[model samples]
Target: MSISFAFLLKHIRPFGTSGYDTFCSVDLANFLIGNLGLTLGDIRVLYTAWRGVALSDAQSAAIIDCAKDVANARWGQLQQTTGSTVMFLSGIQLQDLSNASLGQSFTWRPASKIAVAVRIDGGHGGHHARWDVEGFSGNTDSQGAICHFSDLV
Candidate 1:
């Protein structure tokens, strides 16, 4: 049997420190499953981060560029199959509130949008978090961007 979006969201909640992040991820997942009618097993989640990289202009650009490409590739594959796609970015970057700005700079085609937030740790460890959704229009063009809070519940 396929897993429910809610179930998956609940299972992944502990990893996120913000309700907004969790909401975004789950909402996008639900959108993919409910609207696109894709099975849960068909969905895949990928996590990546650049912790040890040097803090330089080129490094930041390279990291952001790589991330954008990864997001695009994953969504593109999903569009080829289910005509919709959702991606979540979670890890050490979420600790700083400023990280959300990164989402705004990333590009999403045909209405694709990204959801993002920072998960700060007063004393605990910190991480960065994000969610993105890409939906294909009839002509296989991408559609509206929704950034939800459910990604980090």
Candidate 2:
């Protein structure tokens, strides 16, 4: 039960497919603000970035995509502290869900993580150097793991 574009679209009263042409990012953001309480400017930025690049429907879809990404990222962060029961739309490792025809299902539980350290030094001299260290605490090797998938259909 993940939040989807269609689900979000249902929230706005008069925002069916036909509304795309007349409504810009600002209008969409305003629509979402009442439900998600997101910063209008932030969503406007995302909408403006893709504005005029495609047809009206595509632009509207892009804004929805942006909102979905933001929500998913936050959900992922929450999973770090408290594990979540996530549904795999495709597949993970030993299990294959991609080819499920209709009333088929597969369950996959995969976990892994890796630590990393990075250093950058200026070519001119050692005077300018930067170091990045991650996964320094609490099961660093299992900190983050993503389910790999692809749409072959």
Candidate 3:
């Protein structure tokens, strides 16, 4: 009933599949929230930070451990870095996805470094310390809310 390394290896398209190399945080959030019982607030916050970070399925038990850690810590898990699986999630209009190498430990946790006065919120209006802020919606406390800081933002 588990997604084993062997299963992952078997499914990993002769390194063939185009965009199936990793999992997105959005999906992860849905799964964790809907199925795994991870705290919605925890997942939502972590999801907001990375959103689309490429989580390499290449790690041994990286995905599994991620779920466990999220359940245990329930807070302060944003910059997780287990093996090639860096905790930065990103994908189309989201974070942009960053896949891991192969067989690594996953990690997660964080505290927002955004200076409210300086950074934009909910696409309302304002500039981040660096990137343009856009696309993000809902109030800061909304579970669906996300901040996009990019050149195009």
Better of 1 and 2 by TM-score: 2
Off by over 4 Å in 3: 1-26, 51-153
Relative to the true structure, candidate 2 has a C-alpha RMSD (angstroms) of 15.6
Residue-wise C-alpha lDDT for candidate 1, range 5-104, written one tens digit per residue:
4322312221233422433455555676787676666444322122211122322343333334434444444432221122222333222222222232
Candidate 1's TM-score: 0.24
Best by lDDT: 1
Cα RMSD to the true fold for all candidates:
14.9, 15.6, 17.3
Show the lowest summed lDDT stretch of 10 residues, model 1: 135-144
In candidate 3, position 74 carries an lDDT of 25
Q: Which regions of candidate 1 are displaced past 4 Å? A: 1-16, 44-66, 70-153
Which model is ahead, 1 or 3, in terms of TM-score? 1
Q: What is the C-alpha lDDT of each candidate?
A: 0.31, 0.28, 0.27
